[model samples]
Target: MILLFAGCPQSSDKISKPGSTQSGTTIHGEKIDISETELLTALNLTRGSQSASEAAKKIAAQTGKNVGRLSFTEAKSLAYDDEAGTFKVKVVGKKNGKNFDKTFNVTGFTHPYASPPQSAIQVEFKFDAGIEENLSIDKYIEKITPNLKAHLTFSFSLQNGKAITLGYDNDYYELTAQVSNSNGELKISPEYKLKYKKKLRGEDETSVSTAYTSAMPVFTGQKKDYFTEKDVFEHIFNKVKDDPELIVADAGSYASSKYAFAMVLNNGGTLFNTGKIAQYVNVYNTKGADNHREIKNITPAMDNVRGGGITADDYEGKLTVNFYISKAEYIADGNTPDDKEKSGSYTVVRSGFKKLPSDISSNVRSVLEFSLGKITDGNGTQDTWKKRRINNTALISMKYTGINSTYDNWFSLNDDLKITGDTSGFYLILNGQDYTSRMPNHQDNFLVPTNGDENVKILIKHLQISKNVGEEELTIRVQFMGGNDTETVKIKPQSY
Candidate 1:
């Protein structure tokens, strides 16, 4: 059965600000002695045994009357009142140096990798804080007003982590944040950057380091930062010249998800190519009009622009993406490829937004399941549950359409149920040797086609168990999201 799995609080909002960690005691300011951890605990009392109230009490007690200007507040679970389908985050703070408490409602999602698999991964909603989706950053903020102000929406993304890896050096991870007003207009996006570097120690040892201001470009102040292609679609639509502009809007257009851009650009009556599309992007390549933030090849990136640099957030956009389905799912014979089920143009960012094929569900909840029987040791020992070279009791039949996999999604039971040192997404195979997308969960699209004579399949492969505080006969439930309907399947692993 699916239950609340909270061991070590398997999730974190992780909203860090422009501050120093050189602790003498506070975070944003002194006298404000609270870490992000304390802040989250105080904000979300549902996780612990504490609650602070406001009426005549300035700061209600959590432990031995340990209260400050800000206090441990209240929270409402999903089983209570909420329209946006999110939990309530109430905080008591000073509005203008006075007693103020407001419950902030939030719509957030737990990345499957971030939480225990037995729990409802969609406990809240939305996807991970990846570069792939345009997720609502203010999931925990947007609703707060009065005494408390300031909300920060942040995304942590590692797009092509090792951009220029000369024997593992110069790795960059992007942190995007936006400040929203009441009208949701007149906002600013400050790109926080984290750079990773490794120093080789002899032949077998190496150390790594990072800094947010490590290699930041001096492109702020009066120096005008430009907008990316995605910034045009999301923010400045009027400046968009042609359909090609919108086609190249997503971050992945230039490098990774190029197929969708190439296809859509050509169909829009422009003989599209990299050089041809870069011409349209050139419109924004100037001081006043450019994609400085999203400009990959630029030497030093614009970490924090004063204002206006809406360059391509090109992580994910569905200007248009077509799908190719099997004959059995299509139901009808088509004269051309475009006449198939998902053959038409689609503005698909999050599935079923504009259009989607009925058979080609974006996320197939368990259309299938397996009796993920017991997992044993390498020596096939049922005596004790321990890690061995190979396990005797592993659910070899964790098959979803029987993933005809050539993939060895191996992981150490050490980190986040990681697949080959990475704990994010599985491979999405498409034409021309894996149109491999670093798909953020519930954000990017997944298409399945038989590889030559290989059968179309998606297998669970393996389930990584870390600790011992577990449940029995874990029924894995998959929620298949369609254009209009939602289908759910719970797979109860049986003994093979």
Candidate 2:
């Protein structure tokens, strides 16, 4: 339930060559190994009569081909039938099926696109609602790649400055609740296909020295899936549900638990609502047999990213990107931290981010104008906003109009398709209040118009400022989508 997170913050330090090994945090100065990923997860089931380990066993038993069994075979689905004594194939939409690994692969593009709109993966798919044509990441693929979308940390950049995004599946796993498990149990590992096959050089099976050869596109993980909301509690279970009793968590007492994830809990959480049970997808403590507790009959972890050789955890920041100069630490297997059975490599990736310009030129400035400051937080807020018919509700707003120009411009068009919940087109900091996450005007995608638009000799729209913000000075940082450039607009009452 407690995940130990470790990583080096994003730095300009040079990284060692791939094929590294280490344990805990001690890198042994070597090539990056892909076997260190040992996914950690726990299963909690409510049955006052049963012990915690027993609850874990029952979930695993029912997950296998038959109920009351602990061996995983090729036919275990998230759904199962415990015939009072025996468990068997689960019926999904009337047909018995094991969750097959879905594949999504990206190549031909590099990280740090040479320009905006072009993805770092070079592959871009757009949404076509009528046909659901395996659409762009804007569609389903952006979701279920095992919970949270992959951050830029899992990517590596080549000399060409193009990055190969390996993604979150290359590092972490989410404890997802199964559709039927209210208090039953949720699979920690998501079912979207993100599993990869390791291309072992030979059949040694003992030595990982010749495990991989980067001859031609060694990444075997093919992309093809959707995004699913994940619980921060999954990443930190014990903290959220420290009590041994599942009913307590169900009674909503977990909400007041001092260590619960504030972000999720504060917004009215979706966890432990009717009580809870955690069904860890990767319960590797198979004290009886081999790969028995693995979810979906997958070997080791629920998928490769969780078990095979990758390891990652919540960095606990609004956003914290960490990279390691490819290294590996020695972990002594299940019994001791002395053997080298499993190892995964994480190395410092080449940063392809371009440095922002030191100054915004007048031409860029000419494109938009901030309205004269007539800030008001009067009680007639509803009437004022209603007059404008703005979609975003806010305490106060200022006009940021466009100037006549033929060039393409945007307010906060978030072009990065890889990350979710991060489409802040623009940010407003009134005094010291951070209003990046609550921008009503341009929540995610709002395109700017050029001179060609009939009404726009120049048309200004209001930028919503959140309630409770101080009126010291309004600072706006707009990320113009034209070329992924940022422009600052600072306004003071007297100055404006």
Candidate 3:
């Protein structure tokens, strides 16, 4: 059986830095010079997927301080300062059910600290260690396959004080054979193995998948401040009378396709004005469906702030709007001049204004936009103009590479692309319409290079264009230090 999987890239973005110069007094009123090696040992004891409270006890014992019931939520890093002869370890969690913040500086060891390699949690398939069975290759395959599967069980505790078990009741196991000789004599060789597929990513979901054991936070449901279907339509009807043109197309007709409308609020105040803007646009197609529009509140986390730099509290917020439109719907709605006049469809044009918070810096507010054309063709037809969006923007181009061959080479826009110009800011304008929303996909859309010479690969899953589209063309506009640059590229349709 053929199985498709979307893999996640390891995060290379530098986590928040640990405070260096803050030297605190020890319990006995004595100064401690914590060595890097000792600090790393303490951090490793309380790393993620481990018992935080238990590790905290061990750490307190090692450091001879009252570290107290320290709960480990995320382990940032452990760096040694040769000049200061101290190791700074950044950790974010709770102590005694309250927020705890501190860096341990152990004295004694003289060697620099060596951090352990970061890795994803591994899942293993273990046969009955006691049972000894002699069977042919066919029998072995049959026993391990879904046809004659054996239940696997595991349990883990969640942050909310709940326990969950897998491979029980409705949960079953499915195995895929990876051996070279399926018909050969049965042998349990270490080289031959079967990989697990969790079916986490949906068929139409266009983004990379993180490993089940990844440390990154997973967002399962709609954000806390998202608008409901009723909320969306109510706002639309309230504003439709004043701006009749905003009701450009029928939401019912376009709801069948895989599209989305999103709004992002970054460094902004509240969701009050954002809901009003949704109503003013009148873009929803269905009366009460959740798929139409998405609203996101982008704010810096408190844990990421170091000393007194730029914290989430400093900036108000940034608001972005994203409206998804299919090529057929776009043509049918007369968004394109050529098709608009030929289709003889009435066009709706609407605009809204927002007042930036007085506290926000003027330099933070800048104009950035992106557009795409010939996004989809239903007839399986190809066109010369049907290519990736490439322009003078950052002197970069994109190509539609197929799925990853190995986990190490997984596709990640954040890991690959290297932008080196004076870039003020950039935003993707969904639906190829200038007046639409600046909805950004937090996982894949906003990308910044980690290094200068990094060769970034643009995977097929990262592009917003649907694989059903015969030939997809995407354009991106980058606002550099000097002027705006627009670049477009062509991508051939391929399944992930």
Segments of candidate 1 deviating more than 4 angstroms: 1-245, 248-277, 280-371, 377-473, 479-487
TM-score, one value per model: 0.19, 0.15, 0.16
- Model 1 quality (TM-score): 0.19
By lDDT: ranked, best first: 3, 1, 2
lDDT (0 to 1) per candidate:
0.25, 0.24, 0.27
lDDT by residue for model 1 (1-496), tens: 8889767733323212222222221223223334434544433533211111111022222322224444333322211111111233334343224443333332231111111112111111111121122222343223322212122222222221212111122222333333343342224333334332221112221222322342222211111112223333322222222334333342312221232222212222221223432432344334332112232211111111111111111112233332211122222221122232222222222211221224433433222322223322222222221221121222221223322222122211112212232111211122223222211111111212222322332212232222221222222222221112323322222322
**Residue 228 of candidate 3: its Cα lDDT?**
34
Q: Best to worst by TM-score, what's the order?
A: 1, 3, 2
In candidate 1, position 277 carries an lDDT of: 29
Task: Give the root-mean-square deviation of each candidate in angstroms.
Answer: 33.2, 35.1, 34.3
Stretches off by above 4 angstroms in model 3 are 1-33, 40-136, 146-183, 187-496
TM-score, candidate 3, is 0.16
